[model samples]
Target: MQTIHINRAEEMYDHPPIALAVGFFDGIHLGHLTVISKMIEVAEVNKLKKAVMTFDPHPSVVLNPEKKRTDYLTPLNEKRRIFEKLGVDYLFIVPFTSKFAAMSEKDFIRDYLTDNHVKEVIAGFDFTYGKYGKGNMLKLAEDRDGFNVTTVSKKALNDEKVSTTEIRRMLMDGEVEEANAQLGRPYKISGLVVQGEKRGRTIGFPTANVMPDEDYVMPKLGVYAVTLKQLSTGETFKGVCNIGYKPTFHDPSKSAVSIEVHIFDFHDSIYGERVEVFWHEFLRPEQKFSGIDALIAQINQDKVKAEQILRDMEL
Candidate 1:
C-alpha cells in the first residue's frame, strides 16, 4: 500500500478517486474490519481505489493533551502491514494537530472528501469527526457533497462489541483467547531481544529478554504460552513467556516488568535479534516462589503446558 501523510487534502487530489475507510483502527479488530471490508467492496464495484485513512498521535493526544501517553493495540507500521495484506491501494496518515482538531465539520468534509476526490466513505455507525466530534454518519450523508456515505453497524461476538478498547482491556486482563477472537488472530508484540542477567540460564531455562518496539498495550503480568519467531529468518519456536517483575528473585515493587521467553530446544545467543511473540494462552499469574528448586520445577511444568498448548493449536 502507498502510505501518504496528509497535511492538506489537496495532497491526495492528484490520485484516483478512492473509496475510503476512515478510522483510527488501533487493533484492526472485527468491527473495524467490517467497515474496511465494506470500503473494499464498494471500491471494487465502483472501480475506485481501495483506501484507508487514519490519524497519527491519536485525536485524544491533541484533544486531551493532559493524558501523557496513549498506547496502541496496533502501531502505524503494523497497521500498514495489515492494510497491505488486505490489498489496500492507499493508506493515508493525517497528523492530528490542535489546529486540525479545530476544523469545522463542513471544512473537514470539503477538504478531506471533495478536495481529495473521495468516491465514497465507509465508517462505523458510531464514527464522529469535525470540531467537538459533531459530525456523525447522519450529518455526512446529509451533506453529500459528491461522495457516498456508508455506515457499518456494530460488529460483535457473544453480544459484546468487537472493538479496540475491548481488545486492549482483554489483553490487560490476561484474556488472550477473547482478544485473539476479536482481532481474528493471535495477539502479537514485536520487539528486539535485549541482554539480561542470565538468571534463567543459571536455572537451565535460557530466555530471550524482549524490549518492545513501540507504545504497545501490554498484557497482564503472568506466564503465557506463545510462539516466538525470528522476524528476519522466519524461524518460529514454541515458547513460554513470562511477563513480570521477577518477584521470585527480586522485589516486585522495586523492579520493572520484564518479558522473557524461553524457546523450546533453542540455546542460541540471540541478543539484538528482532522477534515477534504471538500470545496464545494465559497460564498463571506471576508470583513469588519459595526457592530456586521450586521455581525451576514450576517452570518445567510451565514448559510442558506451553508445549501442549502450542501443539494443540498447530493441530
Candidate 2:
C-alpha cells in the first residue's frame, strides 16, 4: 500500500476519491480481514480507490497518559505490510494529537468525507471516533448524506468473537498455536539482534538476542518453538526462543526479561542485524532451575522437542 502520513484533512483532497476502511486494526486478524474485504468489495463496485484510515500512537495512548501503554500487535510498519498484501491501494496514517482527538463527529465527516470525495465509508460494528470516542457508526450514518456507510459485524471463532484483544490475551498466556490460528498467521516480532552476556554460549547453546522495537508486542514469558528469518538474506531457520530473564543464573529481582533464540546448527555473530521471529508453538513456561547443570539439561530437552515440532510443521 502507498502509505501517507496525514496531519490535516485538506491533504486528503489531493488523492482520488476513494472507498475507505477505518480502524486501529491492531492485529489485522480475521475480524479485521472481514472489514477490509468488504471495503475492497465496495471500492470495486463503486470504481473508487481502496484506502484505509488508521491512527498512530493509538488515541488511547494520547487521551489517557495515566494508563499503561499497551504494545501493538501489528506495529505501524507491519500493519502497512499487511495492508499491502491485502491489496489496499492507499493507507493514511493519521497522527493522533489533541486537536484531532477533539474533533466532533460532524467535523470529522465534513473534513474527511465531504472535502475528500469519499464515495463510501466502512468500519467495524463497534467502531467509535471523535472526542473521547463519542462517535458511533449509527451516528455517523445518520449525520452523513449522499455517502454509503457500511458496518461489518464482528467475526467469531468457535462461538467467541475474534478480536485483537482476544488474540493478545492468548499470546500473553503463551498459547502460540491458538493465537496464530486466530491471526491467520504465526505471531511474529521483528527486531535487531544485539549483544548479550554470552551465557548461552557457555551452556553449549549459543543464542542471538533480539531487542524488538518499542511498539512491538512481546509474547508471554516462556520458551517457544520459533522460526527465525534473516531480513538481509531472506533465510529462515528453525529455532527455540526464551522470553524471560535468566532466572537460573541471577537473582530474580536484579534480572530483566530478554528475548534470546538459538537457531539449530546456525553459528554467526548476528549482532546489529534485523530479524523476524515467528512464534509457532508454546513449549513450556519459564522456570528457575536449581543450578546451571539442571538448566542446561532442560535446555537440551527443549531443543529436542522444538526440533521435532518444526520437522512436523507444514511450513
Candidate 3:
C-alpha cells in the first residue's frame, strides 16, 4: 500500500476515484474490520481505488491537553502492514496537529476527501470528525457534493460492543486472550532486544531483554505465553515472557518494567535484534519471590503453563 501523508499532499496524487475507509483505527480490531470490509466491497463494485484514511498522534494527543498518556495498539508502521495485507491501494495518514483540529467539517471533506477524489467513504456509526468532532456520520453524508457515505453499525459480541477502550482494559487487566478475541487475532508488539542485567542466565533460563520500538500500550505486569519472531531471520519461537520490574531482585517501585522473554531450548546473543512478541495468554501476576531459588522454581512452572498454552494456540 502507498502511504500518503495528507498534510503533505500534492496535486501529483491525481488518480481515479477511491473508496476510503476513514478512522484512526488504533487497534484495527474486529469492529474496524467491519467497516473496512464494506469499503472494499464498495470499491470493487464501483471500480474505485481502495484506500484507508487515518490520523497520526491520535486526536486525544492534540485535543485533550491534560491526557498525558499516548499509547497505541497499532502504531503507524504496523497499521500500514495490515493495510497492505488487506490489499488496500492507498493508506492516507493525516497529521493531527492543533491547527488541523481547528478546521471545520466542510473544509475537511472538501480539502481531504473531495480533493483526493474520494467518491465513497465508509466509517463506523460512531465516527466523527472536524473541530471537536462536531461532524457525525449523518452530517458527513449531507452536503455531499462529490461523495457518498456508508456507516457500518456497531459490531458487538455477547451484546457488548467491540471497542478499543474495552480491549485496552482487558490488556491492562492481563486478559490478553479476551483482548485477542475482540481483535480477531493475538495481540502483538514489536521491540528491539537490548542488553540487560543478565540475571536470567545465572538462573539457567537465559532471556532476551526487549525494548519496545513504539509507544505501545503495555499489558499488566505479569508473565504471558507468547511467540517471539526475529524480523531478520523470520524465525519464531514459543516462549514465556515476563513484563515486570524483577521484584525478586530489586524494588518494584524504583525499577522500570522490563520485558524479558525466555526462548524455549535456545541460547544465542541477540542483542540489537528486532523482534515481534505475540501475547497469547496471561500466566500469572509478577510477584516478589523470597529468593533466587524460589524465582527459578516459579519460572519453571510458568514455562510449563506457557508451553501448554502455545501448543494449544499453535500460532
Candidate 4:
C-alpha cells in the first residue's frame, strides 16, 4: 500500500479518485475492518482506488492536551502493515493538531473529503469529525456534495461491540484470549531486548528483558503464554512472559515495570535484539516467593501452565 503523509487535503488532489475508509482505526478490529472492506468493495465497483484516512498523535492527544499520554492499540507502522495485508491501495495519514481540530465541518468536507477526489466516504456508524465533532454520518448523508457516504453498522462478538477501547480494556485486565478473539489475531507488543541482572539464568530459565515501546497499553502484571518472534530472523519460539515490577527480587532502585520472556528450548544471548511477543493466554498473576528455591519451583509450574495453554492453542 502507498502511504501519503498529508498536512492538508490538497496534497491528495493529484491522486486517483478514492473510496476512502476514514477513522482512527487504532486496533483495526473487526468493526474497523468492516468499514475498510466496504471501501474496498466500493472502490472495486466504482473503479476508484481503495484508501484509508487516519490521523496521527490520536485526536484525543490534541483535543485533550491535559491527558498527558494516549496508548494506542496499533501504532502507525502496525496499522500500515495491516492495511497492506487487507489490500488497501492508499493510506493517508493526517497530522492531528489543534489547528486541524478546529476545522469547521463545512470546510473539512469541502477541503478534505471533496477536494481529495473521495467519490465515496466510508466510516463506522459512530465516527465523527470536524470542529467539536459536529460532523456525523447523518449530516454527511444529508450533505449535497457529489460524493456519497457509507456508514458501517456496529460489529459485535458474542453480542458485545468490537472496539479499540474494549480491546485496550481487556489487555489492561490481562484478558488476552478474549481480546485476541475481537482483534482476529493475538495481541502483540514489539521492543528491543535490553540487559538485565541475569537473575533468570541463575534459576535455569534465562530471559530476554524487553523495554517496550512507549504509548502502548501494558498488560496486567502476570505470567502469560506467548510466542516470541525475533524480528531479524523471523524465528518464532514458544515462551512464557512475565510483566511485573519483580517484587520477588526487590530492589528499591528498580521501580519501573519489566517484560521478561523465557523462550522454551532456546538458549542465546539476544541482548539488544528486536522481538515481538504475541500474548496468547494469561497464566497467573505475578507472585512474591519466599525464597530462591520456591521461586524456581513456581516458575516451573508457570512454565507447565504456559505450555499447556500453548498446546491448546496449537501454535
Candidate 5:
C-alpha cells in the first residue's frame, strides 16, 4: 500500500478518482472495518482506487491541550499495518493541527474531499469532521458536490455497539477478552525492549523489559496472557506479561509503570529489539508480594495459566 502524508490541501491524483474511507480509525475495530469494507466494495465496483483518509495526534489532543491524559488504540504505524492488512491501496495521513482543525465544513469538502477527487466517500454514522465537528455523515451525503456518500451504521455484537471508547474501557478494566471481542482481534502493544534492573533473572524467570509506545492505551495494571512477536525476526512466543510498577520490589510512589514479559522457554539477547505484545487474557491483578519467593511462586502460577489460555486461543 502507498502511504501519502498530506498536511495541506492538494490533489495527489486526478485521473481515475478514488473511493475514500475517512476517520481517525483508532482501533480499526468492527465499525471502522465496516466503513472500510464498504469503501473497498465501492471502489471495486466503480473502478476507483481504494483509499483511506486518517488523521494523526487525534482531534481531541489538538482541541483540548489542557487535558493531561490522551491515549490511542493504534498509533500511526500500527494503524498502517491494520490498513494494509485490510487491502487498502492508498493511505492518506492528514496531520491534525490547529489550522487544519479550523477548516470549516464547506472548505473541508472543497479542499480535502473534492480536491483529492474522492468520488465516493464512506464514513461511520457517528463520524464528524470540520471545525468543532460541524461536518457529519449527513452533511457528507447532502453536500452539493457530486460525491457519493455511504454511511455505515453501528456495528453491534450481542446487541452492544462496538466502539473504540468501549474497547479502551475494557482494557482499562483488565478485560482483555472482552476488548478483543469488540476489536475482532487481540489488543496489541508495540515497543522496544529496553534495559531494566534484571531482577527477574535473579528469580529464575528472566523477562524482556519493554518500553511501550507512549501514545497507545495501556491496559490496567495486571498480569496477562500474551503472545510476544519479535518484529525483526518475526518469531512469536507464548508469554506472560506484567503491566505495572514492581510493587513487590519497590514503593509504587517512587516507581514508574513498566511492561515486563517472560516468554516461555526462550533465551536470547532481545534488548534493543522491537516487539509486538498481543494481549490474550487477563490472568490477575498486579500484587504486592510479601517477598521474592512469593513473587516467583505467583509468576510460576501465572505462566501455567497463561500457557493454558494461549493454548485454548490457538493463536
Candidate 6:
C-alpha cells in the first residue's frame, strides 16, 4: 500500500474516486475492521479505490498535550503493514498539528475530502473530526450530498462494545490471552534491541533489551510467554519477556519502564537491530526477590513455565 502524508495529499497523483475509512485506528482492532471492511465492500461494488485516512501522533497528543498519556495499540509502521494485509490500496497519514487542528469543518471537508477525490467516506457511527472534534458523521452526512457516507455501528464481543481503549486496559492488566481473543492476533510490541547493564548475562540467562517507540503502549509489568521475530530475517523464536522497572534492582529515581526478553536457544548480539515481540500469555507478575540467587532461581522456574506454555501454544 502507498503511504501519503496529509500535507502532500494535494500533490498526490489523481486516482479514481476513493472509498475511504477515516479514524485514528490505533489498534486496527475488530471495531475498526468493521469500517475498513465496509469501505472495501463499497469500493469493490462501485469500482472505487479502497483507502484509509488516519492521523499521526494521535489527535489527543496534539489537542491536549499536557494531559496526554502514553497508550497506543499500533504505531504507524505496524498500522501500515496491517492495512496492507487488509488489502487497502492507499493509506494517508495526516499530521495532527495545531494548525491542522484549527481548520474549520468545511475546510477539512474541502481540503481533505473533496479535494482529495474522496467520493465515499465510511467511519464508525461515533466518529468525530474537525476542530475540537466538533464534526460528527451525522453532521458530515447532513452537510454533503455528492459524497456517499456510511456509518458503521460499534462491533462487539460477548455483546459488549470492543474498543481500543478497552483492549489497552486489558493489556495493562496483563490479560494477554483475553486481549488476543479480542484483537484476533497476539498483542505485539516492536522495538530496537539496545545495550543493557548485562545483569541477565551474569545470571546465565542472557537477554535482549528492547526499547520500543514512544507511542507504543506497554503491557503490565510481568513475565510473559512471547514469540520474538527478527525483522531482517523474519525468524521467529519462542521467548520469555519481562516488562517492568526490575524491582529486584529497583531505583526510586528511575521512572522509565524496560522490556527484556530471553529468546530460547539463541545467543547472538542484536544490539541496534529491530525485533518484534508478540505476547502470547501472561506468566506471572513481576516481583523482587531477596537476592540474586533467589531471583535466578525464580527466573529459571519462569523459563520452564514459559517453555511449556509455548509448546502448548504451538503457534
Task: Kindly provide the TM-score of model 1 when superposed on the true structure, using C-alpha atoms.
Answer: 0.96
lDDT of 6 by residue, 206-265 (tens): 999999964688898899999998998888899899999898898725757889999998
TM-score of each: 0.96, 0.95, 0.96, 0.95, 0.95, 0.92
Which tens-of-lDDT digit does each residue in 1-315 have in candidate 2?
A: 678888778877788889999999999998999999999999999899999999988877788888745688999998998899889999988988889999988888888777777889999999998887899999988987658899999798889889888898899998888888889899899999999999899889999999987577778899999999999999898999999987777676898788999999998888999999999999999999988889999999999999999996664
Report, for every candidate in turn, its global Cα lDDT versus the true structure.
Answer: 0.91, 0.89, 0.90, 0.88, 0.89, 0.87
Q: Residues 149-209, candidate 4: write the lDDT tens digits.
A: 9889999999999999899889989899999999989988888899998999987999989
lDDT of 1 by residue, 1-315 (tens): 799998877787778989999988999988998899999999999999999999998888887779633788898888898999999999989998888889999999999988888989999999888999999999999997999999999998999889887898899999999999999999889999999988999889999999989878899999999999998888888999999999988998898888999999997888999999999999999989999999999999999999988886661
Clashing pairs in model 4? none
**Cα deviation of 99, candidate 5, in Å:** 2.0
Error of 4 at 279 (Å): 0.5
Roughly what TM-score does model 5 have, to 2 decimal places? 0.95
lDDT tens digits by residue: candidate 3, 137-180: 99998866689999999999878899999999999999998999
Which of 2 and 3 is the better model by lDDT?
3
Q: Which ten residues in a row have the lowest lDDT in candidate 5?
A: 7-16
Ranking by lDDT: 1, 3, 2, 5, 4, 6
TM-score of predicted structure 4: 0.95
| Residue 215 lDDT, candidate 1, scale 0-100 | 75
Where model 5 places Cα greater than 4 Å from the true spot, the runs are: 11-16, 66-69
- Model 1, residue 302: distance off in Å is 1.0
